[model samples]
Target: MTDVRSDDRPTESLRDRIATELGRARDRSVRLTEAVDDDDLVRQHSPIMSPLVWDLAHIGNQEELWLLRDVGGRTPVRQDIDELYDAFKHPRKDRPALPLLGPTEARRYVGTVRDKVFDLLDGVRFEGRRLVTDGFAFGMIAQHEQQHDETMLATHQLRAGPPVLSAPPPPPSVRPVGAEVLVPAGRFTMGTSTDPWALDNERPGHPVDLPAYVIDAAPVTNAAYLAFVDDGGYADPRWWSGPGWQHRSSAGLTAPMHWRRDGTGWGCTRFGRYAPLVPDEPVVHVGYHEAEAYAAWAGKRLPTEAEWEKAARWDPVSGRSRRYPWGDEDPTPEHANLGQRHLAPAPVGAYPAGASPLGVHQLIGDVWEWTASPFLGYPGFAAFPYREYSEVFFGSDYRVLRGGSFGTDPVACRGTFRNWDLPIRRQIFSGFRCARDARPDETA
Candidate 1:
């Protein structure tokens, strides 16, 4: 909301919107951390993730740094502990021993910071500075918190216990979708230049010319992935890249994470509860290599970042890009399975309403779809506010993922939004759809 049209609003509306977003984000953070006992909050569920208590405090620290200190010109509330919460200063594996604030203290500190932010919001101007312009900093902080909330949700998925979370199931697929959609590619704009809250990596929209291609109408589902597993996809080196094969061999990845043998079919654990795999639901908890291997077995390949964007945002008739697959508007519940409305991905064709104009389905949410591209700044890219936000990670070390996942909050996800992780990571809610060069006749 802050990035879309925040500056166009009256001062009151802008402040109200920012306040609402901040509140919503905090609520999610609280729910995630509070659901578990203090022991669970302080324990590191996985080495790749921080203790839940650390995330709780870090969210407040970021808000204080950007909104209270930088925008409001206020002194730090706890200058001594800044390093304790600085993410770059400490990796997730080392966070638990860094004198992190305990559960009670973490909650109280964030509450204090939030109170000060509200006071500052009452008087902060909407212009005269880039960070404060259009309430970008506030919006950014809200997004940051939501991002951590998603991470904490992932941590919950990794935690060992009875179910600590629950939500109603996502709507079932309304109808069958075709196997693939042809993207009649030409020059289509990529990234964003006008979104008020768009992060640095997503700025400076540019046109990308390309040959036509074919892409999956929906993400690969459990049923489809099952075919790969049944065929010994993991054991076959023919389908995997060199590095991918090495990792698969060492890690002994037989199936998607949390998946185990059910008597007659496959079963998967979600938030500690196990159930039979829903054949039509998009597969989750997959790494890049697994997805790549599956694509190869299917006689296809992962889409390039540009190809994925063209399929999602390009409108053939209008010759323009939209903010989402459905249109320029923010997502509704019916649009996609986002914001943890469902604790897992919906069935492949469940969100036909969210389909792209080219007829691609479930493009915005359900799972983070891996792309062929590595993390890189767009052409003419420039860092803003800080390079650590995106620039520092611009290299082949991390692979790019488009769209958002069921754990993703809408504020932190958008058409141009970029997410990257080490290709070997299997703990996140990730999946993919395959693509291929269009047949000569199909291009027309």
Candidate 2:
């Protein structure tokens, strides 16, 4: 993961991280289109998640706009951008469709922009200007699009049919679990917390005191969740939110998305892998509504962002914040189940070293955990222009999720980071863990 430029300055790391992020974006982009149909390409569900076809061009333009046009000060990849899939403004659903990039042309567009991003990143330095903002822009978009790639993998199947992801199911992991403990609430910081590698909204860390509570020693898993299903949990409307009950009643969600029974056991089919769902494997691909339903069923709840941060806090001085639970050291086969040849989710509880201090296993990778929070800025938050990132979605319908999944690059998950999605979106690389009241008296 060497940045082409080897500068001695601190920005060297920024350069390196960007290099990694951009490279990952390109890697996932291929997956986005591979399993999709040409006709279904422009079918967009939401603005944040646009038509698969239009989304490709939008992503390419995004990189050029921020990294090249704004930050690097280059002539845009294309002039008259509005005529050619501009993401800066929303696509009016009623507007007559203009001629758009075909799959071939759009692929070229992304390729052209990606090459420029890496080239420009090699030599640039964000000195007096807002380096942090620029860094987040690059990191967030790369991470953001990767999430989209996960969606395309499944949704494209609905549109046409998805390719069987050749990647095998990840190997099961084994490691010692971290300690489980309750956090005593004091005047602790809430809202977005910043590490050197944080999204813009996560910056300017501020404080929000919380109450003392106990969090899960490990994320909730397929094993534990099976017990819920085995108990006829879905049949009981009492366990579901009103919205969840409506959706489940209408859609008939008897089990987690992609889950199927294998004899008396359960397993999931993801990106073409049909392995037995390890009981300890973290439950994945469930939407916010689904996660909430499970929590209510279990008489527990999803952690608030503040509660999540309290459980997964890092020591800035120790430099452990960079990603791997132990530190910035590259992930080994032992510390976490990431960057492996398998290229898909492993069994949960496999990587004990990756656990949070409270013994929350697999907090950093394996799967993106759904939280009860929504995607919003901290108190007194302000978004940058080219404002689509946070502003468009603020106070909206999106629900927040955390951690990164197996499809995610190792660097993408950060403690206290936030990811948002709709309540019913089971197509992405998403999952859930459980939390509950600290006191036995408070337990539901």
Candidate 3:
């Protein structure tokens, strides 16, 4: 990880950028919550996820913990409720039974925290501790809020009701002529070492050597996944692993979550509205098991974590990695579907400008792509600030997912950022692209 030893302090422009990002994150959270009623906000849509109200207060609680208390050295605003909002202390299924702050109280608490945080940011020095240096604490808090915003979006997708959110459709897809592209054998850097706000898991950039392999030019779309469903892919035990088959059988899942057979066709529910599945859109909410099964059925495999990173960030010409597929510039509307600008994944091959150096489309956004690798730390990995953020989950049980999703904020999304969850999880915005070893007959 980069140490905060530089004498140079934050500039006015830097402060403004941080402030703008924080405001956008907070505003997005409010907009998502406001779209649902108080009853829906308190209702737990799934056992795995917390009630919307718990997340609202949890956002404030975390901002207060990091920005106000840790960075600004302030006393707690509501000391009695800290345990109630502690994620590690309480599980999601039990949170609804807790006495969480109501809508009015939660809004007031978050607003007050924001006020204090902004006040602290105005005059705070940005060169002392790691948390304060380069406004890392503020950036972290903003990212935390934005992450919760994405989680709340998941809640919206799970909630049952008429449409509570809407957005103009994304650009039409141009069906990629080549199904996949060959990434030449090479050594490439896999993570970041200098990004000031990058989390502990993405630190200490390392080298990885990979053989030539072919990866999908775009994510598997609804049209493609539907073919798997139509061919009894789920029922075939040959395509699924032992544990995967058990999970599929127990759940009685024949198709992706939120999808139901409508006579001779299929319809999917998104944010409480059911519509005919969009054939070209990247498939969302598929679990790791399902992604793996689909790959096996297609005579391919999921890309490893290293391979995925190499495909997205490696620049063969320079022998270096860029901060994003499109380069170091922050994301723009034309680059990818992000920041809740759209409630669903854009069509496959839609974001040509966001393509990587090798012409792989949508490498940075649309949905989190499941990889074949398990979630593990690098050779020199060490937890910073706290271990709970990532260290505890580094094991074979959780699968690593790369790229951000439609609800991901640009401030929180990066080429090296890592997300992980259990393989059985299908509620979040997750999908996958297929990969395979280059054949002897194939030429790059």
Candidate 4:
């Protein structure tokens, strides 16, 4: 692992990038967990989420397992607690019952592990092994931590106390986006074979031919979704699928989660604070069932995963796919509202620079858009390093969601990144835009 090639410029650059990303992820984790009191960190905010303290230590344990132990060939720092943090071994609902480390202990443990990781980073080889090749292991660990950071942010939203998080509001809409944009009929690459840090599910980039379709220029907004509520969408059975209606009835879901009737208008509770709904911001915290009902009510349907990808990544002029809506470049503040830059979704058409080549706006961030597809691997899929990451989750039980949300980190949020969950989950920062088959004239 210590062997270094003669020409070290590329290796040095990779190391520097890995270090920076790892540090950024760790800083966010610290901030999220530190904002709340120790009791709150240890308490289970929701049965669907682990205690904040559990997540803090689990982040460290994963780094140790993948980076220090697997890549660097170092001894385990806390081998005794390996099973305690094993996510599969204990579900979120049962995590609080385990003998979890105190916040202080968890912090110290992660800090020590990080020190060892940096030491290993100073001289580790970035070749000769798939795990360490192109610094994939480091990148994987960083992405894992960022994913947890987003989960912790969701837990903050589920808390019953006062708001504990804050960020500047996302930029206001500067350009007027049409209701929808027409994606011309053609084939476009759906996934990635070249993204160095892409996980197993998004591998082996493949061509997906799709019919001409129209998708929302931006995600469905609170104002538009409110129309559905005002029309008594919840009481109507025609708008919802049989299973969707069943879940809706059982769960008592009316407006989006955290929303309540505030006189004639609606109010939403964000991070424990109640306020009037922002009419123009994309509707969030809705599940697949709710998004599906809204689309059906509006005489549209949810876009297939392929259609969503085509709208976001396909460059009509170049006949190729770009990494994001804007281009092959990484996201900037001007592009999208990501990495918790704002506490909520930006207003529709807020990021004009982030529009796709076909003029579809906000395709990369704000809220994770639900799709009309299940979580299945591509045609030539192969499990890499481990199957638990993506392979195990493949089936009809989980639905696919594309596009990252405002809380999502850039490292984990790309055009091809795949997120999945049960159709009834409302605690996640998810939303959807409507799509429909293009008219005969529009297809031409």
Q: TM-score winner among the candidates?
A: 4
TM-score of model number 3: 0.96
List the candidate 3 regions with Cα displacement exceeding 4 Å. Answer: 1-10, 174-177
For candidate 4, write residues 1-444 as lDDT tens digits.
Answer: 357577987888899999999999999999999899999999998999999999999999999999999999998999998999999999999999999999999999999999999999998999999999999999999999999999999999998887789888889989889998999998999899999999989998999999899999989999999999999999999999999999999988888998999898899999878899999999999999999999999999999999999999999888999999999899999999899988999998789999999999988879999999999999999999799999999999999999999999999989999999999998999999999999999965
By lDDT, the best candidate is: 4
Model 2, span 1-444: residue lDDT tens: 454455554577767767877776677777667655666566654333556776677678777777778778898877555455654444535212656677788889888988887888777765656643447557756766665565555454334244444666666655544424565656555444445556656655677666667667667778778888898988888888898889888988888887999997777775555677777667776777878877888778888877776666643344233333455465666666554235555675577666655455677667778888877778777775435667677675888777666655555556656777778887676777677767865433
How far off is residue 382 in model 1, in Å? 1.1
Off by over 4 Å in 1: 1-9
Q: Estimate each model's TM-score.
A: 0.97, 0.81, 0.96, 0.98
Return whichever of 1 and 3 wins on lDDT: 1
Please write out the lDDT profile of model 1 over residues 243-268, one tens digit for every residue: 99999999999999999998878999
Q: What is the C-alpha lDDT of each candidate?
A: 0.93, 0.67, 0.89, 0.94
What are the per-residue Cα lDDT tens digits for candidate 3 across 167-188? Answer: 8877777656358989999899
Could you arrange the candidates by lDDT from highest to lowest?
Answer: 4, 1, 3, 2
Clash count, candidate 3: 0
Tell me which residue pairs clash in candidate 4. Answer: none
Cα RMSD for predicted model 4: 1.9
